[model samples]
Structures are given as structure tokens and as C-alpha cells.
Target: MAAPSPTDHKNRKLLGRLSLPESRFIADALRAETVGGVLLLVAAIAALLWANIPAISDSYASVRSFHIGPASLGLDLSLQHWAADGLLAVFFFVAGIELKRELVAGDLRDPRAAALPVIAALCGMAAPALVYALVNVAGDGSMDGWAVPTATDIAFALAVLAVIGTSLPSALRAFLLTLAVVDDLFAILIIAVFFTSEIDFLALGGALVGLALFWFLLRRGVRGWYIYVPLALAVWGLMYNSGVHATIAGVAMGLMLRCTRREGERTSPGEHIEHLVRPVSAGLAVPLFALFSAGVSLSDEAIAQVFTRPETLGVVLGLVVGKAVGIFGGTWLAARFTKAELNEDLAWPDVLAVATLAGIGFTVSLLIGELAFAGDATLADEVKAAVLFGSLIAAVIACVLLKLRDRRYRALTEAEERDEDRDGIPDIYEEGNPEYHLRMAKIYEDRAAEHRRRAQKAAAAALQSAAGSTTEADRPA
Candidate 1:
């Protein structure tokens, strides 16, 4: 790597002056996601170590299998179940909010623009599932996990891309984000429809009523946690009893929140909530679940079984081979069928790299694996092994591909970042157009003037309030 120039060091110092939220946007949320992925990976690694070590494995197993919660309410679940069903609800809630925002007002709102990712996501899901089913067709009930490898863990994939593809195209990042969002929506639906069994209509109805009341409260601008918290729990519990995954309740409630900005708010309530809770979900909830869920013992016998079993092989192949072919081929087919061209900034090779990265199906993949082989502990462990193996392979392949194209990507990133006038627009766009530069400058000036006006108005209000207080004091005297 080249040594940093003096200008680069100065730029870093300048960036240090930005506030936390400002730094987040400047870093484009990539840093946060990457950090979260690192934490999650660490937690999973810790779990694997704890489960494999003879001294620690017993304690690990005991803690994971221990029951908790109110038994009377049929809510007494193992620690692993709590991690999978309870904590992951928070993660899904944030996903729901993002999905709603995208559908209502973001990129997915436009049909033509959304077509590419939506189509790619659908095919990306279908191909892996088909592959898994084919691979396990002769196996005994292992085909139940066909959906296991279909998911794309956005954080893990993004983290890998962040570390290796620092100079990758922004368009490719956006495409991956959109595709993953859609992929998650599909995964949720699959869980709801295929995984759920024996629904209790009474509890389901109660959940519906609670969700309705929650939506009403939100519409009435009731932002009180006291009001929402108990109601949310009620909905989640009801959904749990109703035999649907309780996490779906979170998604439902998130979708219910208003996505468009309301009067006097800088951003929508949904966006605000997501911004507040995403750190909790990414940093704590998901990582904790990973720790609880990823504790597979990789004993010699288990390792041999993982290779020998058709189901385990299916998951591995589905994630590593199925995902790459599905994602890349899906994108190609989507573009061809829609008569849409790839983003001008993204090449087919870049798409291939991203598709390979998408194969890192860690979080949701494990969850599905657990649910799929819930009847047999041995199969469940095998599934976990397969997921870890497959995801690691995917990460390795993606790293190599991304590194191969790193130089081209680096040059592109540099050109994009070059802004000689420092007007918030890349210099390339403003190079030939003095008028465009002036227009941008005027916009910034007008925004500054508006801020000044708001500040003056606030000062005047403070002065009036002070005078009124003085008058009240004189009257009392």
C-alpha cells in the first residue's frame, strides 16, 4: 500500500472535527455496518470456540438449552430460542422499517429502477432453494432446509466489501443493499408461510388487534415508550402463541409506523426510530443471537458427518455455488428481461464480485437451519457447520476477486472524491460548468441564510419570554 500523503493526513484531521452523526453520514454508514459485522463474527467465533473446548462445551450447552420465561403462558423457551426468536425481532424490526422507507419513498418506490434488484432477489432466492432441494432430494427430510442458504446477510457481506472493496463502485453497493433488503423480505415471508404450523386464531386475532392499536397510537403522534412497549410485547407474545414467528410482529409494527416525514420533523418517525435502534440491533441483539446460535461442536466425528451427510453438503453447495450463480445470473437475466442496462459505473466483473460476496449467508442462514432441522439436534449441528464452512468459502472467494480489481476501483474512488472547489460536488461534474458551481454555491448560501433566520427568531422569542418573566416578578412585588 502507498504511504498516506500530507494532504490525506490533513483531511483525516479535518474529518475528526465532525460530530458523531455527521461522521456517520460522512462515512456513509459503511463503517458502522462493518464494525457490527466484525462484532458478530467475533461472537460467532467465541461460540464456536466455547462449544469445541471440552471444559467449556458442557457449560455452553447447558446455558443454550436452559429454559426461561413464563411457563404458564407457554413462553418458557430455551436460551437459544430466546436469542433466535426474541432478540432477532429487533433486527427484523429495523429491516422492516428500512423496507417500508424504500417502498414508500426511496429507490424501490420507482418501479423501473426497482425492477433490477427485485428480480435479482427473487431469482437469487429461487436458485439456491432449487439447488439445495436437488442436492438433498434423496436425503431423509433434509430438503426442509432449502430456504436456509437463500438469505444474504447484509452486514457480513458489506463488512467484507468494506475491508476488501474499499474502492468498489458506489452503484454496486447500492445495488447490493437493495437486493439484500428485498431478499430479507422474502425470507420473512418464507418463515411466516412455510416454517409456521398450527396457528391459534384467537392469539393471532389478538396480535392483529394489538398491531392495529399500535398503528393508531403512532398515527395520533403518541411517541411514548410506556404506551408502545407493553403493547409491542403483547403483540409479540400473541404472535408467538399463534405459531407464527414472533419476529414477524416486529416487522408488522415497523411497517405500520409512518415512513414519510410529518410536519415539524426533520425526518420521518420511522427513520428516527431506525437510526436510534439500529445500533442496538446491529451491535447487541444480532451479535448476542449469533453467540447463542453458532455454537456448533466441530468434533472429528461431527466434521466427518458434515461431509458425509447429503443435507450438510446441500447447504454448503447452496451457499457457495448456488448463491454465486443465482445472484450473478439473476442480475444478468433481470437486466436482459427488463431491457435495462447495468449501471454505467459498474462492470459485469464488479457484479460478479458482489454476487460472490452475497453468498456470505451467516445470520438468517443459521436461523433457518435451526428451524429446518429443529427435530434433530444432530442435523441442526451439521447445518451450522455447513453454514460456517460455506460462508467462509464465499468470503475467501469474494476477497480474492475484489483484490484483483482493487486497482481499477481505487482509481475510480479517487476520481470520484476529487473536488478541487470543495463545493460538495465532485470536480469532474463541475469541470466544464461554472454556472453549475455557482448554482450549488447559491444553494448552500440560501441554506445558511435560513439557519440564521431561525436563530434570530429563537433569540427574539427568548428575549420576549425574559421580559414577560420580569413583568410577572414586578407585579408580585
Candidate 2:
């Protein structure tokens, strides 16, 4: 190339330093959340319209109540029940895989980083529950639905953020995601403990045995769908018969899968399965469940009754007001007590707006509603209305708050670009003069020291592992 031009050589150097592209699997999963949220919304709307219109309400009811499974195995259930108890298991399975990945190698793998979201999730769940309980005090069975507002729907909340929070800091999204994951774990626990009626240990034992086999197969690198599918279905059936919310089986299987990559393995089985299953869960399972569960009769009488009931009011208020207060309050308290500072790129206002977005508890809230009022169709309808209404209100308020924050963030970015000296320091920070530059220099030095320490630790670990492997290789084998 004729002793490459100076500009061309510089471009080649810069290109060499660039990072590799991100895995497409992860990008697709994130994008699927937004698409799934829209599809879920559409399904809920379609169900509502079908249930409300006088011409098709009866037909909608007929289709929902229709049964078609084998009764000999206690598997015969209404279409709605199948959607809730069966299809939802797929969604939970993907959630379980994601949870395992997070616990193993993701943000939650670090204790200090995980603590903020764990505390926030616990507080987020508790506040909504307490608000529901306080509202339903002295009521007969209304207190049974206390867990209704305790969930934060990850896909729905993320969709809202994706739509209106383009300018928000990445840290805010990370906080929200971690908080929601923890909340889902708690919600699963609630379902297993509170919602389950009569547990048959024999069936549960069978499910456990099947799960053990599934785990063994997975660890051995047995990736055949035919082998795993039958085992999974058997486990689901046994759990369903055991009355432990068949979905728990999915969670159990997900958590049991080996997350670490073997020496010769291209990817961990957890990641492989998650990549394959997440699309089905997001596109089909969740929307199907929503279509069935969200078909509440939105009549004038139903609307009046929904507002009149303490249970409905409790759910609405708990989700709207309680989620915001709990998440924000918990974050503040954690940072205060632990002496951990918030990210410099984010503000308290951004955290508050994120907390509001946490209130959009759609998927799990609806599931809890169905469980809370299993036999009583009238009460179930009321709970559905409350969930829809509350989530909608939360979405609107979150959009407004995020839009304002987006404007402020854009202004901040513009101000930072106004730096004249090209010293890489924002004008606002530069106003403090020499002391600011000295502090910046100290920060750079500290960061460099930390990087060196990490590199040394990693090298030592690799050396030790290699030595151990060499010793084993030289042994009897």
C-alpha cells in the first residue's frame, strides 16, 4: 500500500483497538421484551373488547371455558386454565434461565452491586403488600390477594423505558432490571407457598426425580429436544397433579441447568436453552396467557363494583403509590446506610422516575389475581380491571416523568460538549479550575492501580489452574 498514508495508519490503529461486536442472542432477547410487551398489550385489549361487546361476550366466554385435555390424567381443564397453568410455565422457564445466568455471571454475581437491587426489591414487594393489607384489614378473604401488587413485570416496565427513556443513563436500566429480577424470585416464592393448596408428595417426588434426570442429562451435554421435552412435560404434569402451581417445575428445571461452560463446550447449556426458548415464551406463551386472563367483563356494573371493593382499590393504590415509594425509599436507605454512593451519571430524580416505572406490574400481577380468586369469577374480573387500570395509570405517569428527564439529560450532554480546551473535561466541572483537574488526575491514577491489581489476580488464578491440570495429567491416567 505504498507505505500507507499517515491518516490511513491512524485509522487502522483505531480500528484495531475497537471492541468485538456483542452477541446477537442477547440483543435479540432485549428486543423481544419490547415486542412481547406490545403483543401482550394488544392481546389484553382484544380480550377486553371481546368480553365487553354484547355481540361477542358470550362467544368469548364459551371459548375461554371450553375444555379439551385428557380427563383420565386430571389434565382436562378450561382453555383459560391451560393458558394460565400450562403456557405460563414456558415464560417462567425462560425467566428461570435468565435468573441462573444473572446469579452465576451477570451483575448479581457481585455482592456489593447486587445488594442495592435486593434491598430495593424486598422493599418494593413489602410496601405494596402492606398497602394492600392495610386497605383490606377486617375484610373476609380480601387479604388473600395481598401478593397481587407485589410483582414488577419486567417486559412491560422495560418496554416503557425503551420507548421513553432513550436519554436515561444505562445505570438506571441496570438498577431497574436487577430490582425486577429479585422481585420475580420473591413472587415465585409467594406462588409456591401461598397459592398452593393440597400438595401430593408422591407426585412432587416424581417431579423431583424427573428434574434430577433432566439435570444429569443437561450436564452430560445431551441436547436432544426429544429427550428433554418428554422429561419436562412429565415434570410439569406431576407438579400440576401435586397442586404446586405447575410453573414452579419450570423454575426448578431452569435453576438446575449447568450454567458454566465445559472445556470443550462452545456455550453453557443455560445460555443455549435461554436463546432458544425466550422467543417462544415472549412471543407466544405470555401473549396467550394475557389473552385468556385479561378477558374481564368491563360492564358499567363491573366498573362500579371494581372501584367500590377494598381489594380492587388496594391493588390499584398498592401498585401505583406503594411501588414508587418502596423502590425509591429502599434505594435511598441502602445507599445511606451502606455508604455506597449512587452513580455520578444518575440523579435521585432519575431513580424516582424508574421507581414509578416499576409499578407497571402486568404479567405476574394478573397471574396472582387469578390465583387469589380462583373459584370466584366475579372477584377475578374485578381484580383484572384493577390491574389493567393501575398499570395504565403508572405507564402514563412514568412516560411523562421520563420525557422530562430525557430533556434534562440531552441538555447535560450538550453542556458537556461545550468544553473549549479539548481537555476532555466538561465546562461545568472546569469552572472549579485547578483543584478539579488535580482530583481528576487522582481518579485516573486510582483506576489504573485497580486495573493492575485485577490483572495480577487473574494471572495468578490461571497459573494455579494450569499447574493443577498438569499434575492431574501426569498422574495414573
Candidate 3:
């Protein structure tokens, strides 16, 4: 047989890798997102701390001023805001694309599945803004920070779940994720509408035209990332100049990209594009933004500043108090008044704990704060102070609450593990393992198959009992 072509060889290699079990791959992806997000957060906090120190603060201002864009093209921007505003737009844009995908083809498509999160998210947004306004005694001028608490940081929140262990149920985990995705959509919208300044109509028109051309190419079955990248940059530059918040560029570009992974429509290299760009978006795009935006000028009086200003108080209160009230209370009210129901396995306390964790608003809050108080240094600094304080408080409170809950529920698992120890099997699966470790995980799976069969039988008998009861009641009536 002839040797496979280079492209074919690559495809075969990809297929072989994919044949390495999907669950393991997904688990690894989650692990990476979790660990990486935490690491970036740590770096961001360090930058903030270092930037605030007496002498070190002076060095940061200089470090951030180094320009990287084309001096020849006269497009140079401050490297500080460039990473945060310019590149992080790619992150938001990728986020927007994912949001679109979820709405069109993923969990958000089903009315039953989407309804709860959508409604809860709306309440989640509205309640927090109202709460924030009430606390800040906000007027139109100071009201610019209203949307600060509206986001749900997925990786950070999910990391809390991972730490909580068995205190949370799988259903609760699923609910929070879906709800957060919805929350992200709302936050993006708030950014687009509220944070945008003024528009350059001609430039915007040109960007729209570029977007149209991109869509046309996508429709024509173009599968090249090269086509999308230049156009995407054009879109960002135009939007940046047009006062539309440049990160919206990623959204438009993603809408132009095709995700035709189903049967017999021409396959696009969207995944390949992502394989190239996601690292750039994740490793560089988000982290760089965090590094720049997270540099808060903290003094010895940083702690005291928390309750001093209205904007600072608004941010801190909105996230710590507003998030818990909005997410959990909204969720509870939805379940009570509407036809929505809580996940079967999730306790109300766990739900509340997860919602508290959702208040960990580090990334999007910083992004919005940057936009809202663009030129107002004092306001921006206050906002950053609030964000750091709120995020830290929420993270600590959520972790402690979930830890207590986990300890309460861990008795059975602890007992079972002890039994296993007596029987001489090693406790190798303490926290988690690498993807390779799961290749030999068939024994537990085989036992699960038998358990599932028994479960099906039990469900059948329960269903029959309910049906017979219904029949008897109808006959008597």
C-alpha cells in the first residue's frame, strides 16, 4: 500500500489520539483549565501586590508603558492596556463563539434545559445591580459600575467545586455551569451596550463589511484560519477605533467561522484553528490581561479603602452579598414559582455554596471595570480595590462553607475507603490522576454496568407502582 500523504498521516495521528477515550481527555482539559486559571490568578494577585509597594509601584508604571505595535504604521499602543483590552478581546470573542454554539447546538437550545438558567441569569443580573445601586446610592455618574457583579467566572467557580469534593452533586455542578454560561452571555451584553463609548461610523461600516466578507467565505466552505485571522484583526482594529469595544471583534469572527462537524457537510478546520489559537487566547490572551488589569495600587490603607467610597463599596457589596442573593435566591424563587426543579441530588446548601463561589468575579469584573472607568484613574483604582476585596472574600467564604459541607457528607466515603484499605487495595485515587492512568479503568466500569442493570429494574417497578396508583384513583373518582 502507498504511504499516507502528509495531511492524511496527520489525520490518522489525530484519530489515533482521539481513540484514547473521550472522558479522560475531558477530565484532562478540566484539570488544565482549573490549574492554569488558578496559576494566572496567583500571578495577577502578585502583580497587584508588587505594583502597590512603595518603590516597586514606580517600576510597574514604566514596565507597562513599553509599546509593542507598529511604529511604522503609527499604531503603537501602551503595552499595559494592550494586553488587557486589545488581546483579551480574543478571549471574549472566543467566549462569544462558545456562547453562540451553546445557544444554537448545545444545552441552551432545549427550552426545558435553557429556561431555568436563562431566567435565573436574568434575575441574577437584575437583582445584583439593584442591590449594588442600593448600597452605593448610585446615580447615573457612579452607576457605571452597575454591571460589576453580573459575571460568573467558570474556571474559578468550578475549581471551588473540585475542592468541595462530595459536598456538591453532579447535577448541581451541571446547573452552575449552565447558569454561568448564561451569566457570561449577560455580562458580554452589558459590556457591549453599557461600557461602549462613542462610535466612528465609517470605520464601523468598514468592519461590518469585513465581517460580511468573512461570513461569505465561511459559507463558501473556506476552512483556513489564515483567512479568519487577518479579517479578525481588521474587525478588532475597526471596533477599537469605532468605540464598540474591540473584543467584540472575536465575536464577529467566530460567527464567520464554521462548526460543521456533523455528517457529510464539508469539514472545516475549526478545531485545528482552535488548536493553534486557544493557547494564544488562553496562555497569552487572558493571562496578559490579568497581569495588566490586576495591577492595583494598594497602600498600607488598602484594607481601610474597602468601605470608604461608594464605588468601592458597590463592587465589594455587589459581589459578596449580591451574588449570593441573586444567584441562589433567584434560583430558589424560580423553582418555587415556576415549573423548574432543583437537581435531584443537589442539596439547597450546596446550591447556595456554589452560588457564593460564583461571586468569585476576577476576570470579567476587571474587564468591565477597566472599560467603565477608562480615563478616571481614581474611579478605576477604587473599582480594582473592590474587585480584589470582593473576589478574595467570596473565594475564601465559599471554600470554607463547601469544606464544611464536604466534611459532613464524607463519612460514607471515608468508611468505604477504610474498608478498601483493610482488604489491601492501595489508595491510589486520592485527589485525581493523569489521563494515562485511566486506560486500565475497566474493572470499576464493568461493576457499574451490573449496577446500572439493577437500577433499571428498580426504576421499572417504581414506575409501575405509580401507574397502578393513578389507575386506582381514576376508577374510584
Candidate 4:
């Protein structure tokens, strides 16, 4: 077999180990996403219930249809429009920040590290879109909804992973996160390109100028919500009036933020801003969007139409089958052609499980459904039911697969913890021997103590020098 070259070894392992800092960041992000996912699920349930109940369904529809906001600026919109346009902008802003950070500093910064997920994300998107298009090819005017199934709801997917994949390798989580992030970026692009009606160049120019000012101020180290909030609103409104999706404005602003930290800084301005805004996006903005957007009548007729309507059926099939096939197949093809190999800790089944989990296309799917069928309320409602149904089916199936994998991993972990040597500690921890760690720990501790002592001595010498200089000056030199 022509003695395997060192290059072969180097090329091995797709979704390879992450750096400690990157791992920590992923962990923190997953935690936040898990919470957000729960809130999203709750909000979705509330919406469905509110819309379906016989007594208050009318009230639910009326409330969502209620219009408020100043009309002069073209800001007057229904509650649902506000949720989809205004609030979802916050969600997209957070996504944009995440995408920016990933490209600038996270795993996606390295082409080698990024190649697999990027490919998977693109394929994942293409597959569902293809599936949707194929199903709706015969149906007149149904092609517009192809993008509806292309998105994977990161929050919902991560939430499911958190609940069921507790023992799965971190590489799986990292892969899913990166894949979803890329998926979100593409979804935004599709919205920008396909869903736009007509451009009011004047409004678009004003939005561009506002974005430039915002970027310029940040570059100049200008800060303060008081200064930026109104600017952001103006940009959003202008973008809305410009006939482009207003959420794009949020993304533009987020991308313009500096993602790398400066010297002596704990976090970059982008990170700080994300930290401040993420909770709002997750807890309020997304949940509210879901509450407004996911409220479809799940009557027998609506549920039946999800299967019978060509566009709705395409959405369901595209999300449920196409997502899994695309992500898993794309990953396999990439690994086969490229030098990359799957991580040893993960098997094909694990990949399949993650791929299935990616099929939970809830939030963004609902948003796109609304956009795609803006003039047809009935068709849009059917698409909503289709998204909910497809996502639910995907989640249930993924849960089963993940639970089995998690159990296997738990068993393996327990086996590794066995005290084979009859020692007080587990075999895995003691494999490297505690004595070696103790020595290393001692060396680092001594080095830290030495560094502190030097700092103190340097401070004392500086004080003495200052005191001598003052004394000399007082002597009338």
C-alpha cells in the first residue's frame, strides 16, 4: 500500500478537535441556544393553542392583524409584520454577529477547518431547495417557496441535542453549530436575492449611507445606545421602505462591527454587543416572532392540506427527508473526495443523527413561508402547518437516534471509568499518571509565584526611584 505518507496522517480527521477557547465558546453558545430553544418551543405551542381554540381564535387573529406604528415613515405594520420584520431583525443581527465572529476568529476562519461544514451547509440548503422545487415543479406559482425549507433552526436543533445527546462527542456539536451558522448565512442571502419585490433606490441609498455612518462611528470608537439606537431604527425603516427585507439591515450592521479584540481588552466590541443583545434576541425577539408567525390553524383541513398541497407537501418532505439526505450525503462525499476523515469518536450513525436534527426548520422556515405567500393567507397558513409538522417529525426521529447513541456513549464512558488497576482513581484519569500532572502543576504554580514576586519588586523599585527623584528636586537642584 505504498507506505502511507505523513501527509496522509495530517489530512485525517474531519471535524477534528477544537482549541480549548473555541471549545469553551461553543459550550457557552450551546447553553444559550438550549435555553432559547425551550422558549421558542413554548412560544410556538402557545401560538398554536391560541390560534386553534374555538373561543379565542378570532381574538388571536385580530391581535396578530392589529396595526400600529407611525405611518409617515412607512412603519405602520401589523403585529405579525412587526414580529417578522422588526423583531426578527434582532434575531438576524445576533446571527450576523455569530457569523462575523466565526469568520473572523472561530473555527470557520481556517479554510481547512471550515471546508466540511461549509460544504455540508451548502449541500444541505441545495438539497431541500431542490426537493421543494421538484415537488412543486408542476404546480403553478409554487416555485417561489423553495427557500422555505432551506433553513435549519439553530436554537431548536441545539435544544434537542442538549436534551438527548448529553454523552455524544463535542465534535458533533461543533459540526452542527458551524453547519447551522453557515445555513443561516445562506438563508439570509436567499431572502435578500429572491424575496425582494422592487428597490426604491432612494431609500436604499439612504440606508447605505446610514450603514456607512454606523460603521464609521464604530470605527471611530463611538459608543452609546442613545446615539446608535435611532440610527439603527432609521436604517431598518429605510431598508424596509427600500423594498428589501429589513432584517438585512441588521445583518449589515452586525457584519460591520469589529469582531477582534484590541490590546488590553477583555472582549471585542462585537462580542460585548452580542452578549448584551443575545438574551434579548433569544428570550424576547425570537420567541415573540415564533408566537406571531407559528400560529396556524391546525384544524383537520389545515393538517390535511399540509400533505395534499403541493407547496406545503414540498416543504414537509424537503425539511424531513431532503435535509438529512443532503447533509449526510454531502458530508460523506466531501470526506471521500477530500483527504478528510470522520472523527474517530463519531460514527456514521452519529452523523446521521445530527443530520436528522438539522431538519428542524422552524423559525426561518415560518418566516420564509410568510414571505413566499404574502398575498395568499390560506396558502401561507398551510405552509406554517407544514413547517411545524415537518419539524416535529424530524425532531422525534432524531431524538430516538440520539438517545440510542447517547446510551452507547454513556456505557463507553462508564467502562473507561473502571478501576482496572484497583487504584483509588479511575483508569482513564490515571492512564497518564497523576504524578506527571502534579509535577507540571507544581512547575506552573512556581512560575506564577516567581512572576508575582518580580512584579512586586519592580513596583517597589519604581517607588524608590520616584521618592529619590522628589528628594533631589526638593534639594533645589
The numbered model that scores best in lDDT is: 4
Query: How do all models score by TM-score?
Result: 0.84, 0.80, 0.76, 0.85
Mind giving the per-residue lDDT tens digits that candidate 1 earns over 1-477? Answer: 011111111222101122223222324655567778888888998999999999889999999989999999989999999999999999899889878877876557756666667877888888888888988886754678899989999888777766664555555655677788999999999999999988999999999999999988987888778888899999999999999999999899889877776567677788778778889999999999999999998888888876678888888888888888988898888767755555455578888888888889999999999888889988898899989888989999989988888888788667766765666766654656878778768878988999999999999999999999999989954
The Cα error of candidate 1 at residue 203, in Å, is 1.1
Error of 4 at 163 (Å): 4.6
Q: Which structure is stronger by TM-score: 1 or 2?
A: 1
Q: Write the per-residue lDDT of candidate 3 for residues 1-477, one digit (tens) a residue.
A: 011111211222101111112212233334555654665676687778768778788788787877778755335888876886688777776666556555554446656556556876787778768777887674333777888877767666655555555434323444565677788777877878887767889888988998888888877867666777787787777777777877777766765554435565342344345445666676777777777778876665765776777777878888888888887887777677754444333367876787788788878888888777888976787788788888778988888877877764464334323323232422333225344234335546767898999999999999999999999989954
Q: Provide the global lDDT of candidate 1 against the true structure.
A: 0.80
lDDT of 4 by residue, 124-162 (tens): 999999999988886544787899999999898876666
Which candidate gets the maximum TM-score versus the true structure? 4
lDDT of each: 0.80, 0.79, 0.67, 0.85
Candidate 4 regions exceeding 4 Å error are 1-12, 138-141, 162-167, 410-436, 439-477
Clashing pairs in 3: none
Q: Against the correct fold, how does model 2 do in TM-score?
A: 0.80
TM-score result, candidate 4: 0.85
Candidate 3 segments exceeding 4 Å error: 1-29, 71-74, 138-141, 159-168, 264-272, 407-477
Q: Give the 10-residue window scoring lowest on summed lDDT in candidate 4.
A: 1-10
- TM for candidate 1 is 0.84
* Model 1: CA > 4 A from native: 1-27, 138-141, 163-165, 428-433, 436-477
